[model samples]
Target: MVTEYESALEVAERLNRLTPGEFEKRTGLFSTGAEAVENAVKIARTWTGRDAIVVLGHAYHGRTLLTMTMTGKNVPYKEGFGPFAPEVYRVPSPYPYRWAGAATTETGIAEEAFEQLVDQITTQVGTANVAAIIVEPVQGEGGFIVLPEGYMTKVAQFAKENGIVFIADEIQAGLARTGDLFAVDHEGVVPDIVLTAKALAAGMPLSAVTGRAEIMDSVRAGGLGGTYAGNPVACAAAIAALDVIVDEDLPGRARHIEEVVMPRLKELQAECAAIGDVRGRGAMLAMEFVVPGTRTPDPDAAKKVAAHANARGVLTLTAGTYSNVIRLLPPLVISDDLLEDALDVLAEATRTLA
Candidate 1:
């Protein structure tokens, strides 16, 4: 029940410092990631005077109505939850591993796919009516999917060309989770608005939308806040957590996790035909499960592997539109020994499925 005077201003200042670019930045705090996302869209619409919002396929923005509508998956998030918010258009995400009939390369058909994505958005959702293009730099619940190289920059360019706000929904992949302060940093693409949460307050229920000051100021003051938005206690937690992330260099730790975990997962993939693809960046990685001889997704195998890991005291999450990806999201502060032990447990789980 602490008041805004206690810590909200401090949180805002700290968040502003972390946001990229030289333009004067402004931040608004919210109690949850969904709220942050909802407000970001509102701000974009208000500023652009437009009705359409563009979202990538296999993105998971949040669980609220508008956010759920933005999410690509339908079963658990949006099932029976329609009639949904309108003017929300979906576009292809440039998922490399699953690009049909395309050769697998470092860029994974991104150049070709990105051109098609641009065509779809222009034709389907007319740039003039688009308020924003919101995307998860790395798709979180949609199976830890990382966009192929150059894909993010291209999307940002498209948004800029059309006067649409580019919003990077970094709720799941931000704050050192992907070995960078913001996942968009990997592509060096500066977004017009950045939505952050999850690790922002170290799970203290704080989320923020930081963007260009001029754009953020478009929304009238009273239009943006809620009573509990940016609770003082939560703000205090976020301040402390942010200090820890920088002082401890959690981004470096995430990179170390990638070095340790990715090789092991690749090794396991080598031995198991069910492990179809090993993809993702930094510690935010996943292995998609498929039938032995084909690209056909095998959700059951993913379930079995996760169940086995759980039995061994290693909790795991399954994702993907097809529910066939075993996504790994280990804490940045976890010890090398504990992470290795968990990976060992996961290795055994994959072997059991094999």
Candidate 2:
């Protein structure tokens, strides 16, 4: 563990440099992503004078008691975890690929449907009682479901009009992993608050909630932090990670991964009846396995493919509430040859499963 004074100074310096805006003073560091999100909710509640923190369906914020309540999936993440936190509502995510209609214009349908849902939520949840609405710019554990075009902007407008603080959970999609410093940047939408971790420190335990000045300051100073809120080692790693991402142009590298992976995955979809959808942005992508020629999920097939990939020296993770989707989170530092090799392994796995 890092000494308290040393950690404080390191965090102070880093936050001063990275969050030049008013956030430098308002935002507090946390030992883990879960803690950061927990405090973000606390701050939002205090700022809005509201009761509940609204979450979207298939969202995976964290695993702490409060966060486990916000996660949309059940089974393993919540089976033994009883009685989660209260006032956290889950709504359907903007999943265009599996949306009810067969229209190729998914972005349009998604924009309309999800916005309508948001309107309904605010009405029922009572705008006056709604503290905040948290969502992943790119739904991570929910299957790397990138929102349809204009989806987030419309949602942000809805949240703003309803006086609900919009929180962008960028834990899995930020820090050049999605070909941008932040995934929310892609839509040109500036959320009221942003949550990030994962690759922020290249695998270290650190997360942050940077946001509007007043909202962040709503909580009392001592109410927002932890003993090791910003460990020196993790901060050092984060600073290094930021340098590597900028100097080596990891955002461009992420784009390269998407360009190569998406096309090949699309080919698999055309060839195999069991391949349902290929989606996501940059290096953060996923392909859902389905029952042959149908949208019905097939976790068994996904499991088989994952096992095959592991045997072949490639690692992959499964996601989505149904666990039938394969999510690819290759190290942004992986070589082009290695990236291609992994994709090749995945392609062959798909063929075998098909």
Q: Least accurate stretch of 10 residues (summed lDDT) in model 1?
A: 100-109
List candidate 2 segments past 4 Å from native: 1-25, 101-104
- How high a TM-score does candidate 1 get? 0.97
Clashes of 2: 0
**Candidate 1: where is the Cα deviation over 4 Å?**
1-3, 101-103, 106-108
Tens digit per residue, CA lDDT, model 1, 85-180: 989988777787787636477475777667776887788878799999998989999888888878888888988998999999999999999999
Q: Considering summed lDDT, which 10 consecutive residues are worst modelled in model 2?
A: 15-24
Q: What is each predicted model's overall lDDT from 0 to 1? A: 0.90, 0.81
Query: Can you list the residue pairs that collide in candidate 2?
Result: none
Q: Write the per-residue lDDT of candidate 2 for residues 1-354, one digit (tens) a residue.
A: 234556545554554444323333444667777887898899889999998888877888889999989998897788889878988877667788776644457676676667656676767776678899888988888888888778788888888898898898888888788888778878888788877677777888887777887787777756766777777788788778778887898889999889888899999889888878888899998989899867889999889999999999999989988999999998888888888899899999989987
Q: In model 2, what is the error at residue 10, expressed in angstroms?
A: 5.7
